[model samples]
Target: MTYELTRDRVEHYFDRTATKVWERLTSDAPVSRIRETVRKGRAQMRDKLLSALPADLNGVRVLDAGCGAGQMTHELAMRGADVVAVDISPSLVKIAADRLPNTLKPRVTFASGDMLSADHGAFDHVIAMDSLIYYTEDDIRRALDNLGARTSGSVAFTVAPRTPLLMGMWYAGKAFPKSDRSPTMIPHGPSRLRKTVSDIGQLNDLGRVNSGFYISQALEFRP
Candidate 1:
């Protein structure tokens, strides 16, 4: 099973609750100190993943899975990769398209739907950012397997790393009444993820990025 229920929740949360907040956060707009830290952390993580790819991507096909607002998609296209940027939220996808530079339009395809859709065609590389942080291990493993089968090169992604501060937040967030809660982030350790998706590829840790409330660990999986 593809775990449709979890994905539905993810899709709904991003489309409804997070669309506007994320648009502002990903842009140059000023946000709260905590969110500002998150912005910085995300920028660092984005650069880290990009560094793993070949410097020149002429003729490369890249999938910007869960490409919120298209920042990663923009960068990949600028590197000469034909990028398929897919996100679950149509609203965010539109924002991504709107923000995309006209010169880069020919290099990108912005779509809103399942990022792992086989219909997107095979890819040279895949960048998933923080998109996989909400799913279970089973869901993540299945996603990596699906991507591994379709991708010829490395898959770079992020997870909410298991740490003391985040673990506390995880527990505290759960205390809220069900209706008030957004999609909860599932924290995974780098070591655990290595074992969880071991069958798909050779996984390498790219260290952790922690800026205040934003704590994510980047990993590169080469199939």
Candidate 2:
């Protein structure tokens, strides 16, 4: 599938799954065992992402690119950062906006749009979380270029590892078929991802969390 089509599918899937995604982000008690596992895995990924942020976010400006359900966006605002949270799914964006506390509403600006094309102005930090898993290598490079232009300090994102074992698992999922509505993911290994961001800034490997079949690799780039 084309990148645009894949992105559309991802947006649709997330929009449909917005409520479940919110629960997964906030609550540990998922409806099913599989969902419980997913919750644990995503929590680990969030922790790794949070660890890479600046120690002091007081008055910091942040671009929460692809900020699904405002999970990280809320955290950033709580840390005293002024956040511009952007997501492609309108439903998810609305959910995120509604979930924000009344006091934090003033500190956050929620919008629905493609992160690469949006003009969110400048920020001290740009975080994409687990959102880049749908982008191809070229698309990822383009996104990094856009993010680098807006960020003055650092950019952080997560990608699914492209290892043989993980690729096998992905193929197995396609064979078994969980649901016909699942979104297509484009996995990128650490080496290729490092090269994609090298032109824009210095790449730092934050760490990787192995979540059974796939691995979530956290990376930060400093300009």
Candidate 3:
């Protein structure tokens, strides 16, 4: 078991949570709130990614794995990258499709499915933000391996740092706000993640997600 529950049940809980998140994401008030919150951090996130991103995103095909609400996916597409945003939550995918700009819709697609199970082909880039917190360490390692195999350029993601006390606080906060209902998963520190990436020998921790809440950024490649 990853946390205190099985993977199947965790998936189910997230599927349900996705429904509520989708409702908020689609509503005008919530969307406006998102636009405001994202505006504060989006630029930094984009800049960090671009620092390691391949120079040519134009006409490049990209995959946004675990693309909650499709915020980053839309940004990539808007920058001229053909994007496919994937999530295990169908309702979340629906909101992503709806919130996407009509002009960019042709270049951006939303899919409700597991990234590992999907038929996503080789891509120039793959991004996962605040989305890796749901998996066990073994699964995260395996997923990184698989993502590297599927992407030619880079596989990037943000994960919460592993500190027992910090994790406890973060977990408690998420629960207090009645935020996450999924099973608790172990958080990883930057050192642990760096070691994992080094062990794979295909990925490199080029940068980090500096939003200041125990998050790190990692990049991977296949030799």
Our tally of clashes for model 3 stands at: 2
Root mean square deviation (Cα) for candidate 3: 4.3
Candidate topping lDDT? 1
Best-first order by TM-score? 1, 2, 3
Model 1 Cα lDDT, one tens digit per residue, 72-167: 999999999999999999999999999999999999998899998899999999999999998888888888899999988989999998898888
Worst 10 residues of 3 by lDDT: 211-220
Better-scoring candidate (lDDT), 1 or 3 = 1
**lDDT (tens digit, per residue) of candidate 3 on 47-108:** 66655666557889888887766777777877788898898777677777888889989998
Top TM-score model: 1
| lDDT against the true structure, each candidate | 0.90, 0.79, 0.66
Point out where model 3 deviates above 4 Å. 2-7, 21-47, 54-56, 170-180, 206-223
| Native-referenced Cα lDDT, model 3 | 0.66
TM-score of each: 0.96, 0.87, 0.75
Per-candidate Cα RMSD to the true structure, in Å, reads: 1.3, 2.6, 4.3
Candidate 1: segments with Cα more than 4 A from true spot: none
